[model samples]
Target: MPDSAALVKQLMFTFDDLVELDPMSLGVLIRSCDTDMLVYALKGSKAPIRDMFIGQMSERAGAILRDSIETMGPVLARDVEQAKNNILQKAKNLAEAGAIVIQRGDNANSQVIY
Candidate 1:
């Protein structure tokens, strides 16, 4: 794993960050995220955010995700927290590597930056 503190500082996107994104961009980012983190995020999400990810994935993949969510059993709180952190870490790596771009704010003048 990379330096978590460095990662956090470098790319401080949170669930709030995801919420700030337009649906298309959010979907694309979710598509690139790790499976475990994706699942965890979806499970914790409400309808609108959940729909964003589902809309991005292929039908078959979306179906699989729905099934996984339905069938998932008990999970530890720590594990869930870790999974969210892992997703954030991945996002940080992607941003730092310039593999993805994130819009920093709601301003129309704000350009997308990696």
Candidate 2:
């Protein structure tokens, strides 16, 4: 397995930078990578993760997210944890299940995109 803790931290900074420059919605939008294509990839087999990424931000927003991540480095667990805290701080969810979320297309760090 990879070092998830470090991955989360990197992503947190990436996301923070993206949200700072182009807004969270914009960053998500840029990363969408063609919603239609994502839908096609699903082929009705399973729920597409792209939908989760696109929900809060547009395809353009996705671009920002990608750029931030690329410019920074791989996602770090601490970064992801911070992002998770950001959401948890606002929403209501325990931390135990955070790892499960990673497998569910939340992110490499287990931060729920949706």
Q: What is every candidate's alpha-carbon RMSD to the true fold?
A: 4.0, 14.0
Write one digit per residue (lDDT tens) for candidate 2, span 1-114. 368975664354432222222234333333433443322322221223333444456467556544444355445455554543444322222213342121222345444332
Candidate 2 residue runs with Cα over 4 Å from true position: 1-51, 74-76, 93-114
If scored against the real structure, what TM-score would every candidate get? 0.69, 0.31
Best by TM-score: 1
Candidate 1 lDDT (Cα, 0 to 1): 0.68
lDDT of 2: 0.37
Candidate 1 segments exceeding 4 Å error: 1-12, 21-28, 109-114
Clashes of each: 0, 32
Colliding pairs, model 1 = none
Highest lDDT model number: 1
